[model samples]
Structures are given as structure tokens and as C-alpha cells.
Target: MSTQFLDMRISSDSVQDTPQRELTSSSLFPYTFGDIGLQTASVSPSNVNSVRVTLNAYVRLLMAPSSNPTIIPNATFTVRRNGTTIFTTVYQKPANQLDITYEMAAITVVDFPPENEVLLGQIQYTISVSTNYGIGLGARSFSGIAVAGGI
Candidate 1:
């Protein structure tokens, strides 16, 4: 049995097991805070496969807690294969998505590929983040996933 990411669902259905090994800060693409900022969290086949791509954009608004805040995080997700972008999702800040006075609702996962019924059971997917206007993922960028055939 091959590994998959039990968390990344293609719809209200699939999950993956190859989580921990799939994505990592070093394996991802290092896009600046303005360009196509993205990083490869994890991918199937332990390499770039043409099967499929799934991405989740995680954002944490870091306000200095002072009267003046300058650094704003750009929350978004995208994927690329061999240097070509196959998917991209932009998460905009809510109307008051900046005010650090109160706690607000966080953004959710933005799925793509139209969610077709006849999907590819086994596909190689990669992840990346938008850094054009926000800070990138640092130390806490590690996750877990079980591989197929018991490793």
C-alpha cells in the first residue's frame, strides 16, 4: 500500500497518508514575498508526479500588538510541477482581517480541479505558499503522514 495524506481531501471523500514526508520547508519552492511565493510541503512517488496537486494555505496574522502594525501576511496556496503552475488559490483578508483588537474567523481550504467524480486515485501532489505580501512558513512547517506498504 502506498502512503497518502489522510488530511488533504480531494472532495468530501479522499485523504492522504504521506503527510510527514510529503511537505517540508527545504523541499518547497522559496518564492519571495511578492512573486509566486510557494513551497513544496510533500509529494507522492517521493518526487514530482503528474498525478495531481493539492495545496493548503495556512496564515497567521502577526501584529506587533502595538498601536502601529506594518507587516501583513499574505495568506494563499498554490502548486507547481517541473516549473509550471497547475493550481493557485488566493486568500484575501476579510473586511476587518487586519484589526488585531478582536479574534476573527480564519480562512478555509480553497479546492480546485472542479472536483470531478472520476478522479485519479493515486496522484502526485505538491504544495506552495504565497509570499508576495506576507511572511513565509518557518520552523513549524513540519507535518506527519503514513506511507504505503508500511514504509
Candidate 2:
């Protein structure tokens, strides 16, 4: 039941809505989506008018270093939306040691990597340090940085 999250990253989303209904009275539900509360669905007044729909997903997470990396089975891992775990994931720390490579393609983000990448909007991790590594108990602890963005 142990969980791990690596290469964690936060993403954002935005949805637009219009204040107009496109339905006819002939239809049982004059509202656009009936009772789904869609853009065309009446909000102010049930029979007054139509409306637009808008939704956005906000994402945010923390990425810290595990004080005891040498003793841990893996450096870092990733957290899944469906509550799953992935192994051998790499986490970039706050330093010049991080590596970056770019290729022109259909994808617009690093999360699209085929070999060691993950889907959008997922991030979390855990680890165990050797009893002798780091500054003792303090060595196995690292700070997590918060990263978030979207296109």
C-alpha cells in the first residue's frame, strides 16, 4: 500500500461559456441540457433565459527532496489520479544538476515524454533514507517545490 510520486508537475485549465440558449419549446426541456446545468441551461430563472458554460481545473502541489536518497529504493515517484503508483520515476531538484532536452513536435509540454513521462495533472512522492545516510534523521528530509502551469 506504499505510494510514490515522481516527476511531479501541476497543470491548469480554463473553460468558456456563453449566455445563450439554443432550444425550442417543442423540446420537453426548453433548457439546453435539461438538468445538467449547461451553459444553455437556465440559471437565474428556470424559464427566463439561456446561459453559457465555463469550467476550470486548478492544480497545485509540492516537490521536496528526500533527505536520504542513497538508502531509498528510488529517487522519486509520481502520484496518479486513479490512486495508483509508478516506479523508477525521476524528480528534478532545485539546482543546476537538472537536465533539459527539447524536440519540435505535436506536444507542447514536457509531460508528453514517451519514455519517462506521465499524463497531465498528477504529482506526489515518498521515500526512506538509510539509517546512516544524510545528517542522520535530518538527512533524509528535503523541501518540496510547488510547480504549476498550462497552455
TM-scores, all candidates, are 0.32, 0.17
What local distance difference test score does each model get?
0.33, 0.21
TM-score (C-alpha) between model 1 and the true structure? 0.32
User: Which sections of candidate 2 miss by over 4 Å?
Assistant: 1-120, 132-140, 146-151
Give the residue spans of candidate 1 off by over 4 A. 1-73, 101-126, 136-151
Clash totals for all candidate models: 26, 17
Candidate 2 weakest lDDT stretch, 10 residues: 30-39
Candidate 1 lDDT by residue in tens digits, 60-90: 3332122224534334465543344566665
| Candidates' RMSD to native | 12.3, 23.2
Best by lDDT: 1
